[model samples]
Target: MSDAVKRLAIRDRIAVLDVLRGLAILLILLMNIPAMGNLESARIDVTGWTAADQMATWLQRVIFAGTQRGMLELLFGAGMLIMASRAMQPDGPVAVADAYYRRNLWLVVFGLAHALLFMWWGEILFPYGLAALLIFQFRTLAPRTLMGIGLVVLLASGHWFGTQQYNARQQLLHDAPAALAIKAEGNPLSDDQSATVKRWEDLQASTKGTGKETQEERTGRTTTLAAFFKWNAKFWMGFTSDLLVLIIFEASATMLIGAALFKWGIIQGKRSARFYLALMLCAYAVAIPMRVIDTQQYMTLALDPRPGWITYQISRLAMTLGHLALVNLAISTGVGRWLLKPFEAAGRLPLSVYFGQSIICLWILFPPYGFGLWGKFGMAGMTAIAVGVIAFQVIVANLWLRWFENGPFEWLWKSLAYAKLQPFRKTPSAIHITAPI
Candidate 1:
């Protein structure tokens, strides 16, 4: 189809999708809390010696291990399609494309600021913004064509990521003891002292796991933009490369599927309940056990990093696919309805909640500012904090949405995109927020 001649498909109002987004938001926070603590410390903590730590570690293994990012990517893709369907008209493909791209470009700006200034270099928005540019070109594609492209992307990314993980495992095994040995030979006081306290104060930004700083020198008050870019360029490239492949693939596939489902009348009440039930059963039966076994084995492998690279990749890929299927089914079924209320409310204000969690965690763990609980908190403690955070966010989100048309960040993003203020406070008559069905 000629791009200009092609039409944009409109969307059915699906509250469940927002709930799904909410779930993604919450799960991401759960996955991130541990990592957030690590970012504060600037060093990796691998010891799960205690019972609670072990259980929390295992839970993280089973839930997030690889699936959290994958699921979030899927959700983002789905969200793109949904947003496009809403903002675009059948005969107005160009308008839709423009608006969508503009939204993403702004996100890139947000991500860059978040990464450099906020010191959360682990942010995914930049890559996603980049990928969205590519995906936007596919707006005019047939549903099937989009799905095919998504599958190809997913397969390519999975293979690429698996290979990288394999290499990383080998390097870590080789480097761990050597690095430890270097520490032992250093000056007694310097070798024994942890640089974490110093690193956090210097950066004021929590980065990836705790810091040892012997290998990499701390960038002090004199950190130049050029130097920051040099460090960030490598950091982002390495960071995104690991997950980008998976992100692109799962994201594309789930998005295409979502688009297809919406097109096929399934999302708009076009499909039979019976068909959805069958899909749910098939997805659950296959996905749950596959995830369970893969996670258990993954943990086993993490503890004993001697396995062949090829074997680990195969296991991870298999489980990743299962996780995708499970998530799809969850969304497809009416089950997502139960989760949608708070989630949609939360997602409507995603930025406020997303960055809010980071700020909250920073207060809890950053030394000299708050509790200084970085390496001290066990896995259970982290999970407990995450749960508490999630509960608090839900309450906050609901209350915020009752009076506001969009969450705080969502309003800001919209205003930025539109080049002026969009609606924020809900009018009495417009109090009912409706997703277009």
Candidate 2:
């Protein structure tokens, strides 16, 4: 191929990635809307849901919940590898490695700001930043090696979590009598004992609740910015304390798989249509049944302590891969070409769309402000809102790309990563012409 042809091919490949990223971001918003409005609502018992709400929740669980974020993580890893390849071209290995770390350091800064200011405790960027730092060291390893390491770590972490939960439940059971005696006799229990009893009480209570908002939870969904910040601070502190390990592990594992897939050319849409179709078939064959069983167990068991939770991570991975295969198949076969364009545009500017979603959600949901609709929207309402936001973003992204080379935040992030002012605007004659296949 000629140089121009190669460049066009690269661009087209990137556009495909952008479409995937855009789709993933939209799905993430769909998954997060309920939590953004009322954290408890995301976990609302099935009995509490209206038919529409139940349908929406079921759709989200089956289609997007454990899958979308994984796609994003995979893209991040692929992007990292792409950057590493380019950086190595001219600057040598050490300089490229330095650049990689600096980029991730900046991402960490962005993640912190997003989590603290936006009050989104479920932020992935911070965890992605941390995982990037760790995974960078393994860049020289073979793709299969990286994938193997990731799988082992993911499985181990899942098992560890299950073991911890089971042990905690057992401990609580053992300490319940002592706690009762202390309460009845008006005797003070040790702090550790008190904590155990409290955990057990909370776990038991969680099984019976209709997902009603607690006083503290309701207080957090405030109208005033100051109140929101206060609640966010508390939420951040709690989340950072114990859950950080799981977050890091999950992010790292997904990224590792992404790195492997990218190396294998699957992520870049270089795979044959037949390969993708077969992958989709096999992956769903395993994932759908596994997910159904898992969902059924959760509904019936009500979060009962069980070792089976460890296998859930595997099921989620299967579903994630299945989704990836289906997307690649659609794109490769040109079946989704027309529908993919807007998503590709949005994908090209993912950072902007990501923060924009948060800003939009905050305005619409927070009280006495934009809509004062927080805690009022059921699952169906929230899903509708998410779709509306995505549609708006797609339109905005297409319009913005007409004049700008990058999204607002994308330009800023790239500038920060390079420690220089990068070009932001597209030249007058710089329109992207798609290469003919």
Choose the strongest candidate by TM-score: 2
lDDT of 1 at 149: 68
Please, what are the lDDT tens digits per residue for candidate 1 over residues 191-277?
323343233233322233224431232342113445434554566566666667655555555555555555555433345656656
Candidate 1 lands at a TM-score of: 0.72
Alpha-carbon local distance difference test for all models: 0.57, 0.74
Instruction: For each candidate, give its TM-score against the true structure.
Output: 0.72, 0.88
lDDT of 2 by residue, 264-361 (tens): 98887788989988888888888777666655565454545544466667777878888888777787655577656668778877889988888888
**Which 10-residue window in model 2 sums to the lowest lDDT?**
1-10
Off by over 4 Å in 2: 1-13, 41-48, 87-91, 170-196, 204-213, 300-303, 306-308, 433-437
